[model samples]
Target: MRGIVMAAPGDVRVEEREDPKILKPTDAIIRLTATCICGSDLWPYRGVERVNHTPMGHEYVGIVEEIGDEVTTLKVGDFVVGSFVISDNTCEICQSGYQSRCVHGEFVSQTIGTQAEKARIPYADGALVATPAHPDPELIPSLLAASDVLGTGWFAAVAAEAGPASNPHPDFAPRMRPVDYAARPLPSRSFDGAHSAGSLGVAVRRGARGGGGPGASGGSSGGGLR
Candidate 1:
């Protein structure tokens, strides 16, 4: 299948490579219907030393085409949405609603990302989430967004007390999406930056320091980490 590949810093190309197949008992192959470029993708697209030629996209909503022997919950032809950080969603962390930090969580198509027509999801049982049966067509966009960006944005707001979770109490958990007023453990105030890497930690910009506003924090200073 053809995928977006970052050959090196400052270069991106749509390339063809071998199609993925089941390699393990818990693996799955998906025929992606929706995927998009993430904001972080610019780091490599602008040549900031990603230094690998792997597949590119991650957020995906797709139809299952194949499943491994160990896969149980997912079946062929299931329409599903999977997180960018792939996890079994059944681990202690996942069970606690920290699916992004699943002990065995992973990101797909970094070099061979989800932007393509097909993808192989490893640890299928622990990673993918089935959308509601017979969802509305318009919901697909929101579902796809929930798979990553919206999830992250929503999570970010709660983590920083800007969304519904803004109780200002140290002991209360932050509210999460869909649930409206539901609270989860205090998420990092700064994901997408230092302290924690990947998609979990939010990073505050240097300039955000001058004012100390949450929005100012996540907004990049347009300067690389000092």
Candidate 2:
């Protein structure tokens, strides 16, 4: 299989690499259907971060090709979305909903590159979430966003206490995609509400700073403000 490798700062190549295999009981191999370049990828490309033959890409959506003995929650042919971080979601921190900080967590970008035909995922049961069924091709991009950006925005919104009553300013409307997708139940509305709340927080802050009108106060009770 061929995967992306960053040979050095400002240097990237698609090179032949050994196929990935299950390395642990909780591992799973996925044949990537779609992957996208994340903003962080530019760090190495722009020479701000060190790069020495590093595998690139972390955001992905794919079909399960194989699973290890311990991976019980998924089966072959399942369409799944995985987090950027590999985690054993049973840890106390994960139980608290911070799987990215799980006691046994690893960044997928640091080890496995999804920008290839297939890649092995560690802690498969914990890191991957299967869709109810194969999703529409058009929804693939939105599902892929759930892997990272959408998740981050949702978390930020939750931290800010954004909710249904919170009114996000129009200027921040473009940031409401999570909310729109959430309405369809493809992922969940909580992610949407939180993502909207997070964006509302930004709008509120700007309003408080005199950037917008007085209506920003409507979001204050929704925890859009500190």
Candidate 3:
């Protein structure tokens, strides 16, 4: 298989590499259907972070090609989206909805780069979410986005306490329109109200320069600005 490797700051090349194999009992291997460069990938590309022949890319969606003995939740040919963070979801922290902070968690980008034909995924049961069926080719990009960008936006919305009851000023709605559209796959009604709260934060920050906008004068309360 071939993969992207950052030889140095501002230097990247696609080179032949050994095919990834399951190194742990909890691992799985996926043949990448789509992969993307994330904002964090720019850190090393721009010299802000060190890179010595480092593999690149983290966000991806792929078809499961193989699995380890411990990876019972998935099977061959499953279309899957994986988290950038590797974690065993059975951990106490994961049970509390903080899988990213799971005791055994690690960032995938640091070891396994997805910008290739195939890649190894650790903690497969916890880190990979399978779609109900094979997705259409057109939906691959959106599903790939869910691997990171959409998840980040969703987390941002949740942290902001966005919920169904929140009403955002119409003027700020456009700012969060992308998040709203990307969040369509999510089942939470809170996402509908999340757009308002997410945008309101921006509105409040800008309003600080002048006077706060209507309903943006106070901290978020019940997912709405007071």
Q: What is residue 10's positional error in candidate 3, in angstroms?
A: 0.3
- Candidate 3 Cα errors over 4 Å, as ranges: 164-226
- Summarize candidate 2's per-residue lDDT along 54-170 as a digit string, tens digits: 998888899999999999988999998877777676766555455565677776676898888899998888777777789899999987877766555544544433456666434
Q: Which whole-number lDDT from 0 to 100 does residue 140 have in model 3? A: 91
Backbone collisions counted per model: 23, 0, 0
TM-scores for the candidates: 0.70, 0.73, 0.73
lDDT of 1 by residue, 130-178 (tens): 5546367787777676566544654544453554434554433344443
**TM-score-superior candidate, 1 or 2:** 2
Q: Candidate 1: lDDT over CA atoms?
A: 0.61
> With candidate 1 superimposed using the best TM-score fit, by how many Å does residue 58's alpha carbon deviate from the native?
0.7
Give residue 153's error in model 1 in angstroms: 3.1
- Candidate 2 local Cα displacement, residue 142, angstroms: 1.0
lDDT of 3 by residue, 3-30 (tens): 9999999999999999999899999999
